[model samples]
Target chain A: MKAKAFAARLALALVAAGNAASVACAADFDWKKFQGKTVTFLANNNPVAQALLAHKADFEKLTGITLKVDGYQEQQMRQRLVTVMNARSDEVDVFMSLPSREGPQFAAAGWYADLTPMTKGAVAGDYDYAGLSQALLKAGTFDGKLTSMPMNIEGPILYYRTDILKKCGVEPPATIKDIEPAAKKLKACDANITPFVSRGLKPAIAYTFSNMLHNIGGNYIANGKSNLCSAKGKEALATYSGLLRDYGPPGVVNYSFQQISALYRSGRAAMSFESSNELRTVMDGGERLKDTALVPFPAGDAGQVPTAIGWGMAVSAHSKQPEAAWYFVQWATSPEIQKRMALQGIAPPRSAVANDPAYRKWIEEEPVRKQWQAALDVLAAKGSSEVGYPIVANPESREFIGQAVQDLILKQKTVDQACADADKGLDALIAQK
Target chain B: MSEAAATFTEDRQRLELAALSAPAVIFTVAMIAFPVVYTVWLGLHSFSSTGKQSFVGLANYSRLLADTEFWHGLWVTIALYVLSLVLQLVFGVWLALVLFHAKRLPGIVRSLFISPFMMPPVVAGMMWLVILDPSLGAANYILQSLGLPPSEWLASPVWVIPTVALIDTWQWTPYVALIVLGGLQSLPPSVYEAAQIDGASAFKTFQRITLPLLLPTIVTATILRSVDLLRFFDIIYITTQGGPGNASNTLNIYGFRVGFEFFNIGYASALMLTLTAIVFGAVLAFNRLRGAVAW
Candidate 1:
């Protein structure tokens, strides 16, 4: 009889505790409100998706909602999303997107759900939306619609071998104009190592070339017509080609990110201009880590235009449960989750997490990581998210520009001639009604 | 039986014959005719990546007509076709003759020679990708070790097409060899015996006897190889993606890019159909010329 009475008292105490916890949770946020619901995320097998997948179970436990992630290669994921969005199907609740490339196109087609209202909802307090990078906010926002939430801001970054610069008695280039001299000096120091390398493949070439074009004050279009024939375009092409032709390794024309990264990592290349997203691949751990230095894309003569583009998360406009989907987006991008991912070297989109004492502590743990963090802080502050033409023909337009670059590289056409040809072709493409 | 009943029985037999053939006829029309018909219909429209397809008759065609890249793609396709075919045939005949004459371990050596042909085209291309890598590849490493300057095979525009052709030849020459080997074996041994009786030189006998009898088989091989080569895609797509600046872009690769990469369904449809017409016209012309050959 005494044991039974004690058990009853214990049950009563547990009930009281449960009620207090529920009241507190309801007051701040009720994560269990969407219990038993499921959300599907269509993602690419990129570093961002891999990071999310690594710690997804914690999110599920916190929110009490099941998550289904469908990961694919970059191209295949886009193909699958296009099919779903075109069908107006709600099968995919959330998807990974490249906002700088497809944001305007997707929004104009009514494929992206407006996320501004979702951000203003009841869970807004937990999100800390203002802490996200202002550059990312502008990139993901098109025509006043928040088409997506920034996941990562990746773009061209200059990685140099500090030892090589020291050996050459040269300073790291502070501007695009300084590259030719620095590279020449590095080559003179060591005839063995390639002094510079960048992507030369057709479509991939257009990516870095766009940064050079903009830094030289050349724009993609002028007065609603192709403007690559401008004098700035010629100079940009000459500079890009000249760097590769003069100091780049033989067969650099076939180089893409894979080859360039491998060359740099294996100590065959002294300097490389590649996406910052590749930090983990080349700099994760190596004997050469101590000699590596990271910097914002060397400032261009036109100004400090660093090419930055990013992957983002978006809700399909045709989603059946848009509010519930927003819950997943909000939870994934929460400050706490961003902090966890940031610890693993993912460039956080939130200013608070990036500037946190904890993040600084993490950086100070290693000399190489400190340089990486410093470089990222500068890039997050100043890089332009415009990496390509903003027209509907973004991809098609790139092929033409890439061809012009290749033609110049191969000496098939003079810079003026190639750019002229490309301009005419792009004009025809733009005028295709 | 009476004559009328016999005639009715014959009519029943004919009906049974028609019923037996119906499934194959239906399958052919459904499998082949539907896609062709649907593609032609789509080719007449204006479709963007959004799938908002609308009828815009002849515009995609006229646009392609004025497009310089499309013509360049066609020329590249033809060039790769003729070049790969010629190299494969030349090496194939020579290899087959050697394989046919080998009396010791012929079977084992022939199997080893045919191994490359067993690999899928995509797999073959991937293998060559590693081998031809400029910085960290075995091909360049070997050249450098031999005191020879390593040539930039796929990096130089001048060398890209020829290098890809060489890689394709390495994989596909055996396909030609196997086909020609069968033809070589089928030739009467008596022909060689009779030539030997006359004391003709081995070179003369092969020149006069072997080549004449192999024309029909060689022509058949050329036509088949030609069709495949004109629409070549996988190797180039994997290796250079017709790059170093459109150095090796072909008709099918361009068509696939338009369809999948750019998502311009209507234009891609038109491009593929035009390629089909070209292939068909070329095959017919070749077959007509084939009729006049004495084989």
Candidate 2:
């Protein structure tokens, strides 16, 4: 009987030790904890996504989680994300976002997960939370809600043809006051070429036009009323539309970023105003890249302020596996990955990547890249976050602003009439609870 | 046969027929009736994209009535329906006459002519996107070479609807032609024979006899085509996305944007139901017109 009792006690002790070891293992950080689980990431077909997809195996190996990415064009991707989220589905655990445009609407609708806890808690030590730009982080935040993590900061900048500008004996403008005169000189240099090209499509034009509006010291909304008819507002509208209307290409009325990029690349436009992120596309060839130069939007009476926006990776509130999703987000937005993406033409949201040795060296050696980076640096530091009205009905609100711009360009309505009509519409939209 | 035995056999046959068709009946109800009932039910309630719903008692309908875009979209829908119908019918009948009278054409040639009708509408739109590209399109190149001014076909706000209408006509006219061709081929030979005997010219005979007899077929074809035209979304969407600033916003595109893009489910439902009513009302009016016209 004594021998049997001793044997039982020894067995019990051994089992307890084994259980304690297992508990210790669980407490330690283990990437493989979510092994064999699957995550679906909905991505837009952008430079960041392309780089992420190219290196997806690294993530899967680190986490042992199967990753499936459904990539779509930007517009289609947003529409799909809205549909999936509005259905309150957990099918998609992680997705890409342009927080500047949709942050308020999405956060208000409770479509995005509040990431503050994760940012400060367990994932804090693994992820360098301070590495990202505070401005970009604030852009991703809405009404005290931290909904997304910033990835890239992009805004419209001037891309001018050096050969054309030089032949015309005109120097680059340091302010908006100089653009009109320079445009005339360039137009005189070559009648066959358009002097300027920019997005004229409604809603889309509002994006680039906001930069112009900012330059002249105008605001879209103030104190819950439309401020588009302010003296500076009229100046911004008339200036932007007048540039395109007077010296633009024949079909400039319908031009957006795609057409504007094509025009500049085709050597049809001497100067193009487009997104800073379009370096890869605008710099299509080595020779063209050499001739091309990027400059900050010229300063106006107020100052040189451009409108900038940020794209981010976000977890859905209804995610079935929030931890696994965050692991993927953190791993993707880490310093090393961001540096890699920046070298490949995506504007980095993290200061670490911007200060990385290799990225800085590449910018120093590459002439076209040097100019583009200079423009990005200025805009990143000074750009305004309110590209359009930040409202739940943001898409609807843009139409009012765009219509005014469109009417100005098409010569269909007077500036006063356009603003008044748009004001009525905007006032009504603002009245919505 | 005895009366009792005969009655029993008839009843057994009836039961067997019902048994054979039961699957089809069930399928029709599942596919068609259920969705329609659900759509109507949804139209009566205010709903969010996340499936949140509240009864609002015709508020959505009243809102649409007050909305200017709704009325504008309806006007645009009617304009497209009428314009495309006219172009398709005219070109369709003309092409049918040519194909019907010309027997020497090779089978390959006829097949090539019918190819556009076989192409998907979205595919056709994309193909035209290349052909109508303002900078590098063959259409503009040819025009410039011919010493003519190049037109901004799809880009121009004033020309988008008409250009889209023309593209639609190019695609669907063949379908209308095939239908009218069948009607022409099936016509009684005696009428033409009588006209020839009376020394009537070919044009006169076609107008007096062939057209009079073919009116019913043409009317039927127009009604069918008009129904399709009122719901036109794919080509316009694939081409312009109702752009250059709401210039080409059609009823179908408007409703889709409201429902899917804007995520206002109740308003979208009301828009679609109104569109459906428009389609049904148009068919009823056209049928009445057909009845009034004597063949």
Candidate 3:
């Protein structure tokens, strides 16, 4: 009888806590005051936009503000954001940007308003805002100032054919050494299959190459200089080049991410390194790849792990309504909205939401979900920030490096010669700057 | 007093001539002169895409001099120009000769031959890209069925320039052929018939009469193709984007990359000015050649 009474008191306390949190969340904002204001959002044309549109009406009902979203291709969106920010035009209130390329530049230039003050004290605690995955939050911050809020968390994972592995009587490789043997075995089993594939062309291939280079403990620039000639960096390049030359399909040098994904999906490739975002496309649209398995990128000798590029939302510095923009940003990135997005296969940046019972259930329902979650965990644990190469961010660097890589792969120039030539070009660029 | 009146009448006549050419002068000044002057001015300064600029004297030009990529791109441009021009002329003349003798289904044949010219360059590029795809493309498929090794046509460094040339030729050869055909049709039949009566063979008549008369038309086509191919960007941009490894990059694509992608507008403008001078010199040389041909 005493145990039952204690349980009753515990249940009453939990109810009171939930009620108090809800009331606090409800009291923080006056939605009716901003009824007539229109909040424009610049979004990329991806799955996230459709998920946002589904929740659009709910946001409007809650805040009494009209939500207008404009979707553009990733590059087009980047160009438009830069144009608007540089011109200080009020074309967009909230903009979506990836952390690797545009985020640092935009933040350093004071193109995004500081959100540190808006998120403060008990109000912050009531929402699950504090649970944002650390790496994403860190990426969004510059010099200890919050410049942006993450919309989704993504990282690279190894995608493989479960049926192919079974047919070959081999397990999925967990380390780099195991990959070659497994590839050979799989190839022996099927003469038509390419063991692996990646983007080999310039600019398009640079992103994957950079990630792998970092995974093997290489840096684009070291101590304020180009490090392409470093021992580890050269080794990384050699490994990447050898993989494509030896294991890839005939036209692998010309393949981009889309082609790589298509090869894997069409059952032409045994395995590939691809982003988690491509999971839906491969599984849902690709009937042949429906039974595919996702795994963390095979570990290198140095135990290096690669991270996926993630997107974040930053309030424009020129926003006419800073307070209102912050309000919407806070609402959108809140635990409630993030959980909703997670249902649509978007990995929420908040670990709490990602670890929620409902989210776990959703993952359990899909064969590839566990692998993506596992990869995320691995990346979270081992992935380090990419070393800042002052010149790498320049568009010219992309062209120079892209050409050099292509030349090396096509055997037009030795790797050493190509790197040396590229270094000179980069040095000239740096000098001009 | 009568001589003075005559001098005034001459002055009035000169004024009337100036009035007649004023529109042309104004149009050239507005469209061409202003842009060239502005580009030169921009070339001498440090300008970025975000409207950030400062006067830098000849710094942009000096930078261009040191840019190896620019030089490489120039070579690619010239190689593409020469290759495409030669192929277009050879194939174009061959087609024109064949069509000149066509006595049946001439209209339908001409339309079929001219169809490629009607498609936009970008669309044509995309179509060729699909056709040349190494794995799924029909070209490789046929080659493989013939018991041949698959070739990376677009992806190979050595093959990219020639591949792009092929695409350009496929689209523009018909245009040149049509122009040459028009030239062939307008030629008097009497010249050829007179040669035939004198026991001169078809080849000899073509070599003597047709060749001599077609010199002006050939020069006109060469001039047009040279200018058009010098600034070649669209097909290359759409097809390989100056890859694999800058093998297909032309002067215009290089300038675009420098200006927009690098955000170094001043240096790009300098490159443009240099290209303009080169193109102008080529046109002048072509004009001299045309004059020689006329003589």
Candidate 4:
């Protein structure tokens, strides 16, 4: 009789706590506050955009706002945005961005609308603003103004063939050093297959190479100058180029994500270090769905400091309807929409969405999907956003890094010469700022 | 007619001519003069992204003069231009001669011959990118079957220029052939008849008579092609993107990356102005040559 009374008292306390949480949320907030409004979005036509656009009708129904999308490919989208932003035109209300690549540049140009004030005032009752990834939010903030909101988190990871590694008597790599021996064994076992693959295109090399550089404990700048000639930096360059030169497929100097993903999906490559966003593309044919496994790239001297970056949705500073634009940004990045997009292979930037039971159920459906999520979790926790130099000339800085790696891969220069030339070139850009 | 009436008609004719040609004049100024002048003006100033503009006054030019990458790009552009230009001219004439002698090519066959140049440049570039892939491409497969060594095509820095030259040649030689064929058909037939009467051999007739007369037509083709070849961007960009350690970085590609990708508008404008001068000078020199060979 005493135990039953205690259980009933505990249930009553849980109900009381729930009531307190509900009172904290503003139940009087209005969804149709901006009804009959229209906002234009400059989309990049990437996976995240496609997934959200699939539910465009639902957004209109919920908020009674018209969304006009102007979509283009990634590079063309940037060109269009620059044209509109430079003219101070109000044609594009909201657009997509990569904060790691263009955060400082856009902020310096005064192109982004500050979203911090709006986040506090015009929000839904259950918005849960604090549930977002604080690190990503910090990445989007510049000069005390929140410029954008993270839509998806992504970075490079290793996708290996379980059956091939087992047949060759090789184990999954636990560190950067283990990859070389594993590649050698796999090559000796089968000469027909390429042992390893990654991006080697000049403009594309930096995306994958930056992760290795940070893992090996190197920085793009030190002492207010370029530091590519440092000991750790040269070592990182040599190791990355050597692996591609010796074991990667022929003509890897021309390979980017398109070629890398195609090679691995065709059952030709034993190991692939490419973007985590390629999970859907790699699993399209359903052939490797059973044998492929994903993992965070092996740790280096500094441990697993993987390069993590996310696409963001930002309002244009010149938008005539800035409030309406913010509504679209908030709706697209909400936990519910993010949960829907998560199932479409766009990893969520919200902690609540990541732990939602529906997302967990979707992940458990496939073993590879489960491993992909675990790898993304590690990326979210320990990843750094330093893809290249942290300066206004970040995009230009990537070209120098790519040139150094490409020089090594093509055997046009020794590691010392390549790094020295890169440092000389990068120092000029650094000084220009 | 009275003097006053004639004078009035002359004035009216002058007004009509001016009114008729005004639109073309305006178009020419808008399309050509405005951009060139604007580019020069921009080249002289430094502009920041935050709407900051200041007169740097030849500083960007001085920097361009010392830039080794700019010099390298000029060299690559010239090398690619000369190679593809020569190939297109030679192969184009040969194909025209063959077509002239055969005289019985079906309409379908003739149309197929002209199809390559009709495709857009971007489409051509994308098509060749797949066909030239080192491993999965049919190009290497065919070489292996013929007991020949497989080539890396666009991947090797050593062979990149020639490979890209070959792609351009494949796409444009037919257009060149059509131009040469028009010249061939317009040839007076009287000369060939005279040579036949004299029992002159075919080889000698071609060397002594036909070759000299074709010079004017070939020079016209050269002037038309030099303008395009110097600005060759689409194929190289889609295929290599000035890769493998800047092996194929032409002036056009480098300037584009600077202006669009880097947003270094001042330096990019300077580079573009220099390229424009080179192209303009080259076309002028070719015009002089064409006049000299105008027989």
**Collision count for each candidate, in order:** 0, 0, 1, 0
Q: Report the Cα lDDT for residue B50, model 2.
A: 36
By lDDT rank, best first, the candidates go: 4, 1, 2, 3
Tens digits of per-residue lDDT for model 1, B93-118:
99888888885756777799989989
lDDT at position A38, candidate 3: 88
Least lDDT summed over 10 consecutive residues: which range in candidate 4 chain B? B45-54
How do these models rank on TM-score, best leading? 4, 2, 1, 3
Summarize candidate 2's per-residue lDDT along B46-84 as a digit string, tens digits.
865334578887898999999999998888788888889
Residue range A196-278, candidate 2, lDDT tens digits: 88888776877888899988889888888888888888888889989988877765656777778877887888889999888
Scoring model 3 with DockQ, what do you get? 0.32
- Can you give the TM-score per candidate against the true fold? 0.87, 0.89, 0.82, 0.93
Which lDDT tens digits does candidate 4 get at residues A258-356? 889888998999999999999999999898899999999899999999878899999999999998898899899988999999989899988789889
lDDT of 1: 0.83
Each candidate's DockQ = 0.56, 0.33, 0.32, 0.53
Residue pairs that clash (backbone atoms under 3 angstroms), model 2: none
Docking class of 3: acceptable
Q: What is candidate 4's CAPRI-style docking category based on DockQ?
A: medium
Model 1, A1-433: lDDT tens digits are 9999999999999999976764554366767677789999998998888877788898789878899898898867877887787678999999988887767667767888999977765363457788888788888887899989887667777889998888889899988999999999888889889999998888887778888888888888889998888888888888998888788888777788878888889888888999887888887457567889988777776876778777889999988988778888888888887887788778788878877888878878778777777777777876776665777667778888888877877889988899899888899777753
TM-score of candidate 3 relative to the true fold? 0.82
Which stretches of model 2 miss by more than 4 angstroms? A1-27, A122-126, A361-365, B1-24, B47-53, B130-141, B193-199, B287-295
